[model samples]
Target: MRAARLRRGLAMALTACSIVVTVAAAARSTVPGTPVPPRLPAMRAETLPARYAANHRFITESEHAARALGDEGRAGVLARLARGDRHFLSFSPRGDGQVVEVLGDLAHADRIAVVVPGSDTTVDTFDELGTVYASLNGGARSLHAEMRKLQPDRKTAVVAWYGYPAPRTMSRDIVTTDRALDGGRRLAGLVGDLRRVNAAAPVAVLCHSYGSVVCATALRRMDAPAESSLSDVVLFGSPGTGVRSRAELRTRVPVWAGRGATDWIEGVPHVSLDLLGAQIGFGTDPVAAPFGARLFPAGAGSHSDYLRPGGLPLRNIALIALGRGSEVSDD
Candidate 1:
């Protein structure tokens, strides 16, 4: 009777959470955008210039569309992105849009870090060196800058990939893995491109919040050897990763997990539930002992503070990305 009562209570709580999230999401204004080209050139060292040109064209066109829609905020952002200095592997203006931006010399870098952002991220909110909490653009720039500071001689690169439509926080979608599953496939595709272009670079994926779930799903689909260039998976500020333990992930790379001392995600329930044939929660707190992820230090910060500039989390993340995980100080 106790077990049954527990399940019943969980179902009720989940239902309430979903309703609240859905209502909040409904109150937000949706951004208007144009459809991106259906096809683009494949990523290769020799074809990089062509890809840049294509992205520039897309950015220009998207800017025009945003201007037409009177969303000067997004139009201005796109205008800046179209500048000659910017480097984007891919760009799309559909829905919340997607951007794959490179922060360093990707063609020659020996170490690469892919920053996967969580919910409430969009092109309009993507900051370069500016401060915007949880912005993929800001986080990627911060991580790359930290990596360079730590190892000036190391050839490193960082990719800010907003390739998936991250759901709004506190929304019904965030409670389920549907978006994460789709995001994982997209992330896998991005990794495939990276491997093709720089097969020798050791790569680390730094996933935050909902992005952790996406990374876990992607890792499960990969069967790389223990010595593969994909070196590590780092999860921070995560609620759960859809798996109870690292062994279930089945990826050869080392899995690391951490949380800022005051991250709000710690309060989120870390249990899965079956509700009318649909799974309503991600399973397992990755930092928990049973999950088997190597722990790292995140210091004191909130949910969006993990990637803050000069923070301990950013430094350790850079260390892991550079294949120097042994040097990360968990204390």
Candidate 2:
């Protein structure tokens, strides 16, 4: 009886050990099927706040000056103004004294659009430029509204970038090109940050007016390994982007160009050769150009009508944002 009892106990012990071993093996085999999520960049809390403060200080001084001056004083007042109030400016970082508005979560956005404004644009003037001329001349708000309408399901963000020191006026001088290049670099950096924060998102750049010049310059200067993440580039009412040809821009990214027939840029000399002073020009008109951009038939409104509500330009932009050109109405 004693021997039988001992045998039974040993048998039970062996069974328990086997069960433990099997459970351990099962646990080891059950690895997670989901992918390890990508890490986001560590954004220092202080960095953005500090930048905002500087911007506020600059804008406050300018606004006070403008208020002191009468209606006649408004004529010479700076065309561009920073976007934020004193608190916003106080927290933001200064990048070439340009305006930078962060609209969405850079970490998980589905789509990102960067709107680079043109000549005489500053942080303050960013929004007003659209409203002052008429309801038809809507600015950043119009662009944002159109984008949201187009991409209702996806996370979309628009950056009203006034980062480059734009020319105060239209000038043939090299300063215009220099300022554009500066803006482009800043844009490139911003793009890099966006990508670092969310590698899966697509980024599109809309360069308006002289901002196109900056975009072109940045593309030309960007070397290999630094050029990815840009899915599309659109230029509106651009005189020139400093590239002799679209191919010279050296970007695999699709280039979209368009200008209203009545755009003043058409009248400006297209090229600057020493002997020609400013030549009529060569290369394709962005609107009619062979490049794959969806051409919007902007009527006689010139450079400023691109963002007007219910307009062809805004509709086309909306289509681009939504990733569907087929939805755009001809009207």
Candidate 3:
């Protein structure tokens, strides 16, 4: 009787999740306008400081326009951008999805960490306030603080990258690579842009969950920037890196993988497919022996706990961002 009740309850919860996801996806698709940020001139490392100012001006204009259009929520986003408190690398007010954040100084930071988030993230949720370093923006802020604590003399920056559309909770898209493939190329290109702007600094991509798929997509491309420009690619709470082996990634930089002991993803079968010779599910467990990623210790918790402050995962992520892998705990 207890088992039956448990099964029934689980089914009901899944059904509710399916309904919410479908409705959200439908609402997202029905919306016609995808608000784009105002155009700015071509960028160069030396001119990025000024470009940030110019972009902020355009965002402010758009925010006011959104207010006139009676979109108070969007206007609120614009208002936040207008506050001059953040160093935004890019922002798009129109889409339910986008990237609009930065932590610490970017123009001259000697080390940088670009965080790629996973499922169900949107522009609105990107800025959603959370307690205890729970939100992506908050987590980035936490990581930046950790970096500062580790090396007060060194400059550091963390980017909360959320440009790609995430798979909804029950959408079939979540089980497929339709989004990850595109997101991967964009992520790689963005890394190249960071490379050009901060030429002397070491940069890393800290991929969590589905974001690992995006990171793998870029690294597999022949045209992607050479490994020297990227310091590391770390996968945490990863589904897979979308490769047969780390060597298959076709990059020279060391690839690292970690998972908290309690992370549910650890039990997911590592398998990817190319149906009839087309790309599909990403395969290979990043932390498994066959995956060939340098295994590192992570804090004990579920998927979202990797970036929590005072945790092993956060500390190791900071160490990797600062290129101090030797300092990471090896348990």
Candidate 4:
């Protein structure tokens, strides 16, 4: 029985790699007049409880670009953003897709939650009405709303980080840590920027699916000050964090993991291997005993169900983000 399960796991991982290689090769053949990636400007310095004029300028430009292009769906989201006190850390209409939007006032916020999205998520999908990845925008809004409901006086913010290009499919891109490594560096830079923005404010990162791998990498590389201020990290519906144990994540802060009973990620093999000179397939299930993370109560729901309105997972995640750890429920 053990051998059979192992074989099945190995087959799944290999199949994912082979399919990804083919897709990657085909993608390399570029078509004529394919739009080139956007060139972003240099980042400007901004103080904590401070604002960057450069970022705001980029936001205005991006909003104009969306509206000028006659993309109603994209324009609508930008229109809403224009009316709000939305503080944009960065924005670029690159083919790679990049955006860092903050809901609530980060300048005055005492607590912040950063949501790192998984595969198939992109700046374009933020307003894509019907897909699960649309939550790339909605999920943060739900979390921010739930956090406020607990105590309206508490100042909190939710950041939807679409800075890294997510893998288009769940095949080899996920099995490898290459993208996660890039994402990790971006995450680290964000954390560093946040520290400069408000070092005293507590920050929590909510990582989903492949995003968990990105979070783990960031944790391992982030400077001590940035790590110190990041109070918690919640991994929900995570396939694997690419680390064998939470301790391997190299942060003293609290690391939490949760999964709904119906989450399909439970079926994925929790194993790792080295293939073609790259470490593939993260090992050890995060919610399992050996992964060494605090388990939280996540009600029965499938992948993408964690941040749904009124879900148990949303509640607990908010508590963690709010630094009200005592209020979180154990599974």
Using lDDT, give the best candidate's number: 1
Once fitted onto the true fold, the runs of candidate 3 whose alpha carbons sit more than 4 angstroms away are: 1-36, 129-132, 222-226, 275-280
lDDT for each candidate structure: 0.82, 0.57, 0.75, 0.78
Residues 1-331, model 4: lDDT tens digits? 7677567667876887777345445434543333343344443333412343455555556667766767566556556545435666666554435677788877678898999988877556764426443367788888999999987998998889988867766567877888899999999888887777767789999999899999999999998978888999999999898889998997899999999999999988887777778877778899999999998999998898888888899999999999987888844
Residue 293, candidate 1: C-alpha displacement in angstroms: 0.4
lDDT of 2 by residue, 177-293 (tens): 556656678777767766665667787887887778788777877655446777778787776676666787888977777677678877544433322232222233455454344
Q: Give the least accurate 10-residue stretch of model 2, judged by summed lDDT.
A: 87-96
Each prediction's RMSD over C-alphas, in Å, is 3.5, 27.1, 5.1, 3.8
Q: Per-residue alpha-carbon lDDT of model 1 for 54-127, expressed as tens digits?
A: 88888999899889999788789899889989899988765567788998888799899999988877776677
Candidate 4 minimal-lDDT segment of 10 residues: 41-50
Greater lDDT among 1 and 3 belongs to 1
Where model 4 places Cα greater than 4 Å from the true spot, the runs are 20-85, 129-134
In angstroms, give how far residue 251 of model 1 lies from its true place.
1.4
Which is the leading candidate under TM-score? 1
Question: Which model is ahead, 1 or 3, in terms of TM-score?
Answer: 1
